[model samples]
Target: MAFECVSRTDVGLRRKVNEDSLLVRTERGLWAVADGMGGHEAGDVASAKVTEALMRLPVVYGLDSMIESAIVALQRVNQELIALAKGNAQRTIGSTVVGLGIMNGRYSCFWAGDSRAYRLRGDQLIQLTRDHSLVQDLVSAGMLDPAEAESHPNANIITRAVGVAEELKVDTVGGDVMPGDQFLLASDGLTRLVEAQELASTLSSNGPAEAADRLIETVLARGAPDNVSIIIAKAT
Candidate 1:
C-alpha cells in the first residue's frame, strides 16, 4: 500500500509568529504536527526543532521500528528543548506533537499534549488522539462538558508536551489501515475552530489538496486566533 499527503500552515489573524510546525513524508509513510505553546518563549524555535529531528529519521523496516524511531526522536528533542530553555533562563519552552506512521497495512498514531490525529473511514470521523489538556482532563473526569471544554478559558492549557518536563510520555493508538481511509494530523488552532462533522464532510468530499485548502480557508474565515497547521493523508 502507498499513501498520499497534503499539508498547510498559517500564522492566523492573531498571532505574530507561526509557531506550529509539521512533517509530511509519504514515501516513508510518516507524518507529524507540532504546536508550540503560545505563552512560552520562542515557540517557533521549539516547534522547528521537533520537525527537524523527525526529518532526520533513517529508513526503517517495519511499523514497530518506525514508531520506536519517532519516540526516540521526540525524547531527544524533549531534552534538547529543556536545555535550551534553561540556557535562556525560561521555565519551559514546549510544544504539543502528534504523529502518524503507516506500514504493513497498519497505522500507528502517537501524541503528546493537545495536537491531534483523526481518521475518516467511510462517513464516520474518529479522533485518534486525545488532548492532554486541563479541559480534556476535566471532561474525562466528568467535571466539564465536552462541548463546553472548547470554549473554556483554560482550553489552551495543555498538561503535557515536549520540553515541559524531563520525561516525555507519548500516547499511542494503532489499527489496520483500510483502503480509502483518510487521516488528519493538526494543531489545536484548526481543531479548536473547526468542528469534527464539518471536517468529516470536507475531507470525505474532497481530495487531500482541496481538503487542506478548504480547512485552512474555514479557519481563516472564522478570524483564526492562533497559528494553524494541518496534514491530510489517504491510504491507497
Candidate 2:
C-alpha cells in the first residue's frame, strides 16, 4: 500500500505570525499538524519544536513500534518545553498536536488539544479524534449544546496541549486502512471556518494537493482569524 499526501499553512488575515507547523513525510507514512496557542509567548517556537521532534523519530519497523516512538518523541518535546517555560517566569508557550501514521495496512491517529483527524470513506465523513477543549468537555457533559459550542466564548480554550505541563497525555486510535480512504489532519483554524460536509465534498472532488488548496482558500474567504494548517492524505 502507498499514500499520497499534501499540506498547507497560512498566517491568516489577522495573525501577524503563522504559529502552525506540519510534517509530511510521505515516504515514512508520517504526518502531523501543530497549532500554537495564540496568546502564549513564542508560540511559533513551541509548534516548530514539536514538529522538529517528530521529524527526528527513528525509523521503526512496525505499527506498534512507530506508535511507541511517536509517544516518546512527544513526551521528550513536552519536557523540553516545560523546562524552557520554567526558565522564563513571565510567559509560557504551548501547542496542540494531531498526527497520523500508517504501516502494514493499518493506521494510527493520535492527538492532544483541539486539532483533529477526520476520515472520508464512500461519501461519508467521520471525525476520528475528539477535541480536548473546554467547550468539548462542556458539550460532552451536556453543559452546552453541540450547535452552540462553536460560538461559545471559551470555545478556543483547549484543556490539554503539548508543552503545557510536565507530563503530556496523548490520545491514540488505530484501525485497518482501506483502499480509497481519505484522511485529513487539520488545525482549528480550518475547522473553525469550514463545515465537515463542505470539507467532504471538496476532498471528494479534488486530488490531495487541490483539496488542500481549496480548503485553505475556503478559510481565507471566511476571514481567517487564526493561523491555518492542514494535511490531506489518500490511501491506495
Candidate 3:
C-alpha cells in the first residue's frame, strides 16, 4: 500500500521560533512529529536531532524490524542530545516524539511524552498513543477528573521525553493496516486548542493535505501560544 501524506509546522502567535520538527518519508513509510521543550537552549535543535536520527534509520523489510530500528535510532539521538546538554552546562533540552511506520499490511505507533498518534478508521477516531505527562498520570490514577486535567497547573509537565535521560524508553503499539486508514501525528499545540470531535469532523471531511491545513488553521484561530506541528497520512 502507498500513503498520501501531508505535514505542516507553525511558530504560532506567541512563540518567537518554531521548535517543532516533522518527518515524512513516503518511500520509507515513515512519519513523525517532535515538539521540543527548551526555550533559549535550542529546543528546535533537539527536535531536529530526532528527525535527523529517524532519517538515518535503515529501511527494513518488516514492521517489527522497522519498529526496532526506530527505537534504536531514537535512543542514539537521546544520547547525542544528552551529550549536547552536558557540553552546554547540562541545561535540559528535550522533545516529545510520536512516530508512525508502515510495512506490508501493518502499522506501528511509537511515542514518548505527550505528542500523540490518532487513527481514523471509517467514522471512528481512536487515540493510539497514551500521554506520558503528569496530568495524564493523575487522570489514569483516578486522582484527577478527565475534564479537570486540562486545566491542572502541572498539565505541561511531561513525565517522559526523548533526550532528557541517559536511557530512553519508547512505547510501541502496532496493528493491522487497512485500506482508507487515516493517521494523524501532532504536537500538544494543536491538541490544546482543537477538540477531538472537531479533529474527527475535519479529518473525515477532507483529504490528507486539506485536513492538515484545516487543523493548523483551527489552532491559529484559537490564538495558538506554542509551536504547532502535524502530519496526516492516509493509506491507499
lDDT of 1 by residue, 1-236 (tens): 87888999999999999999988889889999999989888899999988898999989899989899899999999999999999999999889999999989999999999999999999899999889999999999999999898999999889999999999999999999999999999999899999999999999999989999999999999999999999999988
Residue 85 displacement in candidate 2 (angstroms): 1.0
The candidate with the higher TM-score, 1 or 3, is 1
Residue 15 of model 2, lDDT score: 95
Angstrom error of the Cα, residue 125, model 1: value is 0.4
TM-score versus the correct structure, for each prediction: 0.98, 0.98, 0.97
Model 1, runs deviating above 4 Å: none
How many clashing pairs does model 2 include? 0
- Residue pairs clashing, model 3: none
lDDT tens readout by residue for model 3, 129-214 = 99999999999999999889767898889989988888899999999999999999999999878878899999999998989998
lDDT (Cα, tens digit) per residue for candidate 2, span 41-103 = 888999999899999999879988988898899999988888888898735689999999998
Q: Which ranking of candidates, highest lDDT first? A: 1, 2, 3
Error of 3 at 28 (Å): 1.0
Error of 1 at 25 (Å): 0.9
lDDT of each: 0.93, 0.92, 0.90
